[model samples]
Target: MVPFGRLLDALSEVPDPRRAEGKRYPLAPLLLFTVLALLSGATSYRHIICFLEQRRIVLNALFGCTLKRAPSLNTLRTVLQMLDRDALEEAFRQHARDLLPPAEPGRMPVVALDGKTLKGSFDHLNDQKAAQALSAFASAAAILLAHTEIDVKSNEIPAAQQMIAELGLSGVLFTADALHCQKNL
Candidate 1:
């Protein structure tokens, strides 16, 4: 179903992590640029910056913002790392919802829920475990619905259920590994 809010407005709800004294860019525009860059297949921070610089004028007109250039690599990385994870996740969920059209009657949208451990996330020296998350993907639209971390003290089952409940995903056919087919799912 089509979400009810604008993506930039949704992004604005995410708490800014930068100090007010030296903040160079607005959080919402920087976030929107980053999102657009990722959707355009820019993989690295440098590539994202390059994407912005290359299309600065056009994108500025499109987004209705007059940014002279993209934020520096250091600023982008630091702000991203310091932002509240929950707020960012909520914003992403809303944006993903907005990307879809209304669901048709009698047709079940297929969503695939999967949990996987992220590679290269284990901090060997710090003794941290590999980070894992449960992701819900709208299969037909080829877009992510939502994802949540499987915390060290918890497992995928609760995370999956929580995500499903929070997104209010009724009238949809959800597919998952056998692990998610247990009672109360």
Candidate 2:
């Protein structure tokens, strides 16, 4: 899990997707709110909005800002839609890396790699398949180190390779299913 303060600092680096004109809320606060809401068990945007509404004062105090009001569902949707997803993921990984403790002498960290499908993400009406993702997990910390979506046209093997290369993981023991048993890796 990411420390809240570090999470804020990392997320603050992401550029605001909204235009300056008539912008009511800052991106950092909004993103912070969303993350907090998710941590608090919000499963959907409506729940996030509701959570923010119920904890508006506390959130304002925690953020040290008078947002005047919580963001609406539409605001959240628009921001999520427009935000650069790659940048957000990079920030998450960077923050997680910062939180990791140094390796012990002659001991390497254990990293787990796996592919899983997101539950209930299939668009049944449109006959779309569920989303698949390959994730690198820190076994000790029990936190996600990095992940990448497996494109519909592609397979988890390539996604795993890409994610591993992107993370540049070294001096760590990686455990994955036999599907990742490639000579190059």
The TM-scores of all predictions, comma-separated, are: 0.82, 0.89
In model 2, state the lDDT of residue 117.
Answer: 92
> Model 1 over residues 61-144: C-alpha lDDT tens digits?
776778877888997888888889889889988888878667888888998999999999999999999999899999889989
Off by over 4 Å in 1: 1-6, 123-127, 183-185
lDDT of each: 0.84, 0.85
Clash pairs of candidate 2?
none
What tens digits encode model 2's per-residue C-alpha lDDT throughout 98-150?
77788889989998889999999899899998999888999888888998889
Lowest lDDT sum, 10 consecutive residues, model 1, at 1-10
The best candidate in terms of TM-score:
2
* Residues forming the 10-long window of minimal summed lDDT in candidate 2: 1-10
Best by lDDT: 2
Score residue 155 of candidate 2 by CA lDDT. Answer: 85
